[model samples]
Target: MRIALCALLLTGLLVFPGVLPNSPGHLGSLAETALPWFGLGVPLLLVWAAVRRSVKEVTCVLVPAVAWVALFWPGIVDFGGRDLGRADFRVLTVNVGGDRTAPRDVARRVRATDADVVALEKVPGPAMHAYEKELGGRYPHHAVGDTLGLWSRYPLRGVEKLDLGGAWPHAVRAVARTPVGDTAVYAVRLPSVRVGLGKGFTVQERDASAARLARRVADDGTPRVVLLGDLNGSLRDRGLAPLARELRSAHRQAGEGLGFTWPAAFPLVRLDHVLVRGLDATGSTVLPDLGSDHRPVVTGLRAAR
Candidate 1:
């Protein structure tokens, strides 16, 4: 028991680097949601050490306990207190649960945000008409690609489909003629990751797709670019390192809290995101659930000078 606890302590200190041979696999990616909870194991070992009255065991437990605190303390405490200089406009992204989520409910939430642009994924053919009718009045310009769609108050130009190695059109790009300037917006939905005993973690497709998306974003010459939708991988995941290096997450810069936005009932992981390049994020936050499993992510941005 002492040896096992000591090993657990050491693992916590290592922070689960991705290159390790026995690394948690798909489990590692999902494990991030409950990273802080791993610290709870340290207390159990401490108590066991106390009962055994073993000095060595107590000393070992301290290593992991301290390591866990050092790693997660910043994430737990909100450091999101920057005075958003001047927001030009806001964008909201939501996965409207295909045909399951009522169009009226989704439309109500979109109306509530009053965002300049709105991006939705998993939009079904059956519910397309309803959304068009409900959002058409407020947002005059709109485009749909496969199951994804974007609605904008500004004029949409140079609309094009984006193929991120998906069989269907899961991504599209358009130039929004805003009051300040024309901004490139990409609404995308990456392939979902799966976990199974045989495959352990299934994200090779998602990773490949992410790489393609990163390449496209890097190649874009637009002065201002914004990506809105479900990438299925969080900013922290190494698989998303390419995109992470090229784009900046709004939540990291201006969100007021942890900014988690999945399983809206009790968000554990942030699968949805608003990432930008050549623009400054003034404010970012998660909105209340719109009768969908994933909550909406909204961000205010300013064109970078």
Candidate 2:
């Protein structure tokens, strides 16, 4: 019985990858929504093995234990990033949770970052004025469409709304004339997904929205592109695979630690991202929670010379 139990635990550990939340199917949503929690199983299994004190059983458990660490240790530890010198631009992305977060406070926190560009999502209609007034001096150039907005210190041009197969446009594109060159920036907010007993993490809409966003990104002619937004899904989720293939996630490339940014009180998953192409992210990180459900993500990107 001891050996049999150890074998069962080992099988689960080895096969965990098969259950990773990387696809658009229903099963994938459950896995994606709770991807981080999967690591806890390793500790639980370890405790069980120690309690049994069977030499053979404990030895067998080591296989799955090593596998778990191999898969998740990188995220758990802050491997740090290379010193790429000064960055040309600093960008901040945040979902201010509509009325749940105060616009003045949000603007104040953003100002503190001294970001070159700020992308905001879930801006309620009434709070627009407050944000505009609060962010005016710092960011001279601004664009707003539906729930998405972009505030930039640099000159913004050709601002256009993007239709991501939603009721209203939830994304906007603009060109920022920076010291390095003209860089295309996108402020987007993909449809939210649910993780519950009903639909079991419904992501059909999010998947479609991601697909549309991916096509738009691919068609963009800009040599340098930066996408800032509340992606509503983690990088591990396969629905965003198209975008992932086209761009590099700053958090994965240069961030410290896991960089999770949702449920700000205690972020367990990363639903926000800064994805870039043709630019190098010198660093990426999640800022301290600013009274919103989603914590902001800040990244420094250097335009290619």
Which predicted model would earn the best TM-score?
A: 2
lDDT of 1 by residue, 184-239 (tens): 89998999887787686677788888899999899988888999999886777767
**Clashes in candidate 1: how many?**
0
Considering every candidate listed, which one attains the maximal lDDT? 2
Q: Name every residue pair that clashes in candidate 2.
A: 22-238
Q: Estimate each model's TM-score.
A: 0.86, 0.90
Q: Write the per-residue lDDT of candidate 2 for residues 188-286, one digit (tens) a residue.
A: 999988866655777889989998999999999988899999989887777778889889898777786778888899998889999998898888878
